[model samples]
Target: MNDQPLDNLDGDRDHATAGSGHDGEDHLRAPAPRVDGYAPLRSYAAIGDGRTVALIAEDGRIDWYPTPDLHSPPAFAAVLDEEDGGQVDLAPVDEYRMRRAYVVGTNVLVTTFVTATGTVRVTDSLNTGVAGRLPWSELGRRVEGVEGEVSMAWRVAPGTMFGERSPWVEHSPHGPVLRAGCVTVAVPTLGEMTTVAQEQDISGVFTTSPGSRHLVGLAATHDEPVHVPVPEDVDAGIDRTIANWRVWSREFHYDGPWGKAVQRSALALKLLIQSATGSVAAAATTSLPESWAGGKNWDYRYSWHRDTAHTVDALFGFGLREETHAAISWTLRTLRNPDMQVFYELDGSEPRPPRELDLPGWRGVGPVVDGNPAARQLQLGVYGDVMGVVRTYVDHGHLLDAETARTLAALADAACDAWRRPDSGMWELPELRHYTTSKLGCWQALRCAAHLAEEGHLPASPDRWAAEAERIRAWVERECWSPELQAYVMYPGSDSLDTSILLHAHSGFDRTERMSTTIDALRRELGHGPHLYRYTGMREEEGAFVACGFWGVAALAQVGRTEEARQWMDELLETANDVGIWTEMIDPGTGEFLGNLPQALSHLALIEAATALGSGLEGR
Candidate 1:
């Protein structure tokens, strides 16, 4: 599929609608159409089994999914390649308005399509493990008519290895078996739909009357011997999968404003977890350009030390101690090497190296790359990221073994020696700069080390750490701050403002008038009305980092600007799709989404911002 904007299509008007009530009619105007095939982003609900995840659009299309495993090749690649990309679509045959939600407290998704013919509901989920044991290994979809008879069609096209490799299918007495390298695909049907192999893909169609039901399942195998189950067994697998999600989601303790959004984010985080290794991926599918075709595409299938630590903190906040502990233990096991690379595969495999692919990128963005070169960059902040998670565990009264403490201390000592070197900051820019945020991260590490030592949680030289932290702080204040610009620069001696600096106040760097001035300066220079850019000119050069906008709201709330923070918070919330999902970036000019869709970082920032605003309201 070409990456041209969907609005450029001939029948694009079929999906147009006025924005909801937020600011005013003009504030909600849709952006201009593009010749590209990229559609206006839709709300997507994620479902997973702690191994692989599937993204089901509000319109009932499974647009993005990595099969067999989170890091495995994508089965539904339409999210990246619109036309040739594979997808599993189950929707009404007639034009239908849709409303969707998750089964309360579970990852099972329920999408209802209301058409002139009638209304039908579709439930989607991956068959999950039972009591920590792998199940029948299936992706199940159940469609039932809720009202009048509604005709529906379903299609399944499994793209091979990021759209480069195509699978071959042959029929047997049992059913169909698909082969692609080490992966295998099997489908069992409970409806009267013909399964036929079309040029490099397989598809089927089914319809139902009121009170009727249909079921379809896709199964795959890795190293183990494969088995194809009968279609009748699909119902049992669906029941067990739904039950598993329900029981697991019951562990959530969050019950605050934006509770639904929080739960969804938690589910997303859970979906990214690799059940076999307990490691969490940063995102599901990769090579979705951060800034369309501008060379900002990255692979997020690996686990980043920074992202995992933040995820642990977020999960801890929701009272998920078991999951938090599992992640921490995974970190300890995988990060045994003192010279930790930035990221690793879920099973603690080697760092993923950057490799170019033959397929086109999402929205016609070229250079569809796989793996990430950032994995090998010397980012000093990783020291802080690791230490931060350790400190959080110790502070929260979670047990940290003596060996873990000793390893942490040694890691901190390594940071002390490495902090002076130049490396890529959190943003992962290609060019290495003396990033102020990176230095601040090192400072934070030493400070956290000092705190842990003083609390008797670890054996460390507090005096040395304290002195080192102060030295870094002085260097930042003296070298990184631009008195002429009245704000801290992106790097030393550079006047460019980076949205990352907004993190200082949240990280407890400095909350005085100078910090406030810096925050306000970032708001003025980077703010695109309500949606702030990560840095100036990023929209054309790099994708607008949507997380930075939430960071702005959190920064304002942190500095006691409650009203303005709330206003911006409302604006950000309003930008979410009807079902409340956020992408990595939002187009400032058109309100169209850019970059990767359903980004985990963007949702995490939303949770933080919403929680901060909710707490402020309670305090008042």
Candidate 2:
């Protein structure tokens, strides 16, 4: 647990992920997914028009980003310390052949390198606020050539972390400004401070031809007040942030059937929602390790109240109820500080503890960690993740004003006086007990606080939360229903077989016969087929848990087993990652992407298994 040592500066980019020569112990070994040029968390590819997000990589190297948001600190970490983290590279000076996408309904990325003297493309985006976030975060990247004659060579390095800060280069009045504390960054095609190879780089070297565009922007500004950036006004703010994400994905109203993989997992959970603090980051890169799983490296940027309560109930089923009521008013105003923290720090406080970062992870699988001990673990499945987002924000009619109905009646009387204590459940796991999804998350938070206090809007004591939600559904079917390991076990005496009980069959608490024979006993004890593992032995401890493979495809589409839930959600979206993003573990036979990248609970469990395979499951 290296707390802080990562050196490599005085000339940055001297390569070899520069977290070098560490003898003070723990240079972290056993890392296999990568180690040298760091790129393969599914070869990156993520841009954002929301508040902040960037990943890049198929060799065009942005690596990982964080500056004006997403809990801002990282100013790029080379996807976890490639020569002291922070890179902007931009491909082609020779051999190339990339191919990204996104620019359709926008989060604007585009890639396309194809060298041997032609096609450049590039694109990327972060610029926005024609109607949403943009106080100055513009990333822009243009580069277009589209045929013969290509020769790019950019660098823009920033790098810092475990060393705390670096990148300095002020010139302002709209030019090279790249400070690094209250982060100022601007990169107007970076035409100076060149060292490259000795590396203090903001390098240059351009040369296009057919059509030629080459405008590389960067722009940051955490404490805001430093605009002036005008590479033609940040390429017209990346064409008005790609027309504000294609008018929010053409008024996104999901037409079902993997409609372009559910609008690219709803624009990768709308770039993990950082809009000033609608705080949704459950993945935008952090320590990135789960492969060779050492400290199982984590950071996931922060803000998790159970992945923003299942991403505001899958963006309120794509009707997009204002980022699920601004991530349920930023998770009930950060649990009013009396505790229930399970993740925070998109400025809502509570992180500051998890340290361990002398740096190596993301390719070395060390203990890179940043800040998260599950915010002092007590994850009683966040009371069914805050009553499944207050029962989908009061069944979409929305009216729990009075301080969100006194914080959902003090979280349904504190989940009915703590449903049989012993927490750290929903995989926060620190050895507390009773975890059958923390006793069905306090029996689905007193059955959703007795349906939000019988719709009278939470004044709740509702018959002592309906008799402690029927004594937590009869104490999780008498101590977590193991019946000799037929199913439900990861806790009461532990025969362990969880994937968080495959979402208690979409929380009807067992849909026909012990969660349908515990989904074939969790696909024969933590399946590796459609990738499962979130409990029982944890597959030598990591990969395969991409939202428990969409909660076993929404528990086989709410039990009717809809054609094995559409062939296990079409083989789990064919292990997404060239664009339709999905990471937080995979690689059960090289599907690759392990731990963190666009993972907001694996795209909110693939939009709740494509909205339970397009609903109509009579009362489910």
Tell me, by lDDT, which candidate is best. 2
lDDT of candidate 1 over 1-620, digit per residue (tens): 01111111011221111221221223222222323644455445677777777877656777777767877777667767777667777777777666555665566766667777786767787876557636435788888877787888777776666656776776666766766657777777787766677645566776677788888778877656666866667657767876777677787776555566566666666777777777878777677666645577777788888777877878888877777887788888766875588888778877756788777777777667778787778887887878788888888987778888888788778778788988888877778888888998899899999999899877876888889999999999999888877888888878889888877777789777777788888878887767778875664576467788888887777777768787887677666665455677877776667665556677778777766666666776
What's the lDDT for residue 32 in model 1? 27
- Against the unseen true structure, what C-alpha lDDT does each candidate score? 0.72, 0.73
TM-score of every model?
0.90, 0.37
Per-residue accuracy of model 2 over 393-458 as CA lDDT, tens digit each: 888898777877887788788788787788777777677777777878788878888877887888
lDDT of 1: 0.72
Backbone clash pairs for candidate 1 read 1-83, 1-84, 3-37, 3-363, 3-364, 4-36, 4-37, 4-38, 5-36, 6-38
Q: How far off is residue 294 in model 1, in Å? A: 3.8
